[model samples]
Target: MTELLSPTLGGAAAGLGVAMPMGAMSVLLLQEAMRHRRTAMAAAAGIAAVDLAYAALATGLGPWVASHIAPVEAWVRLASALILLGIAAHGLRTGWTAPTPPAAEPRGPATPTPPAFEERGPGRSPGRPAPPAPSGPARPAKAFARYVGLTAVNPTTALYFAALTTAQGASLATGAAGAAFLVGVGAASLLWQQALVAVGALAGARISDTARVWTFRLGYGLVAAYAIKIAFPLPTPG
Candidate 1:
């Protein structure tokens, strides 16, 4: 492992460096922080896991995979773009149709009624309200699954690792050197993603109630924008 130090640090730096750019995934990370304040860690873990896996794949077998998959690159990009668009559309619909918080109950003579969904269950008093269901689908495991799926299909990630590994040539791509680089990548990726989660959570905390609602609406819009950008990138100059 000591011999691999150089490669590891190099890989880690590269991995962390590449991940710093803000994008659709960043939005989702921030969203998770805002929603499950406590579970952001889990989501971060998931993001890290995908990063490490991609790093390893890029270093270990990127050339072979890239070559074999080249034929279908366009399809993969299209599918990824479509998936993003679908998610954005669903979020937009859900946000639009979401019920407004019920009016704060007036204090005084009449007892206030609970929202229909929050009505008391068996063994509970009629007046007692049930716990509300989660506003979005962001359980830790689900968040993890989501990141894994999104990152897996992200062509840019695969290409980044592939380019880096291939650029190292045969000399740097083998044995202890290669191992070290992968290690570095994993470490760097872990650190960066966790920081993003923390930052997101902090942002979530600072936002006002009204801001939270608008933020959600804005996130959906941004995601849709990302999807459109992905699906229809501008043509390069001739």
Candidate 2:
């Protein structure tokens, strides 16, 4: 088992290589974390789960998947680009709307008092702001599902895993080495994704609402540019 540690270390490096890029999926994860900090762990778990699964597949059928996916890579890129654009548009739309506060009745005077906790709703408090509605989907489960699907469709992820596994000879890892390598990749990906979630939470806490909206707009623009580049890439000259 000690001898297999080398493979495990290699897998960790590969995970970092694949996950550290600033892409649309990463942007979405950060935005999701900022929106629902409590559920960010779940979203992070979803990210790791897909990574683990992909690592396993790469270990098992790396060569076959790599060769087969190359032919259809363009289609996958298009799909991912479209999904990113859709997410960007929806987020912009949601950001435009202001959160609605409960209407208040005048308390024996011309001025209206803000609604009390009970007046707002059950288990609600004046100190706490009303929760922002989720941008992509209504609930955490849906968000998790959305992340899993979106991340899976990213062609770069599959290509990354396929290349990494092939380079590391994952097909020959066998037994303990194989298991360790898979675990190592999963651990690395999980750690990085959770860190992103924490950073996003801090950003949400420290920044003003206007800053959040503007940052989101900036990210959306970048994602749109990436999508456009992927969708209509320039032709190579002979």
Candidate 3:
């Protein structure tokens, strides 16, 4: 019971730790929530689903990677450190450049210009009719699938799960304990994602662009520090 409980707790902590960072993805989630509640909820679920998948995969793969890493431990660590540093650098760059959400769009009663729509035809002609604009709300299922792919492709997140799995030890990655851990990860991540969506839907406009920028910077800064720690390990006591 204790063994299972420990992994479950660890997985919950791991889930929150990974999901708490507010990056571009978080901003996008918030923005969508403000405009389309159903789509945003679906997206949040998709993101959590990906996290659960990554956690499960990591739980199974970490032990194998550790066993085989002895021959090239230094190289593997170096590579992992580099990957993390790259992610941090990209995050920092985007943090400065990422566009503010629609909430930050100029607030004044002015006629907004309609952007030009794309024309699909064999050739441009005066008689060619522009495609009709979409008249309905965004599809929730599409949002779900899109977010699932977006979350799945995030390398930093993948590495995070891998790190957590390796740290959790092989003993906890089997049978009931493993199942408990996966459940914890899924539940915690889903709850967090939903909370973000709710906040966006309820009061996203209250958040400032500066706050978003700083949040992104801070999250990536921590990642960079972790990468540095990995790159330069402390010497063990004799």
Give the clash count for each candidate: 7, 0, 0
On residues 1-238, what C-alpha lDDT tens digit does candidate 3 reach at each position?
7768877876776566566556445656666676667888998999899889988898888757766665555455566566666766765665455433334222333212211221110011222232222223369998898778766756557777666555433544466887888888898888978987887788844256666556556556655665565554433334
Error of 1 at 38 (Å): 3.7
Candidate lDDT values, in order? 0.52, 0.54, 0.62
| Predicted structure 2: lDDT | 0.54
Q: Which tens-of-lDDT digit does each residue in 64-165 have in candidate 1?
A: 543455555444445545654555465445434433333322233322221332111001122323333234546777767766665555554564455455
Model 1 vs. true fold: TM: 0.53
Most accurate candidate by TM-score: 3
* Candidate 2 RMSD to the real structure: 12.8
Misplaced by over 4 Å in model 2 are 62-138, 205-238
Candidate with best lDDT: 3
For model 2, residues 1-238, the per-residue Cα lDDT tens digits are 6787877875675555445433334545555565566576677777777878888887777445434566554455465456545544644554444342232221222222221211110111124332232344236676677567655654545644554554334233476776777888799878978887887677643223455456446544544554464455433334
Model 2 — which ten-residue stretch has the worst lDDT? Answer: 115-124
Error of 2 at 61 (Å): 2.1
Ranking by lDDT: 3, 2, 1
Q: How many Å off is the CA of 45 in candidate 3?
A: 0.4
Which wins on TM-score, candidate 1 or candidate 2?
Answer: 2
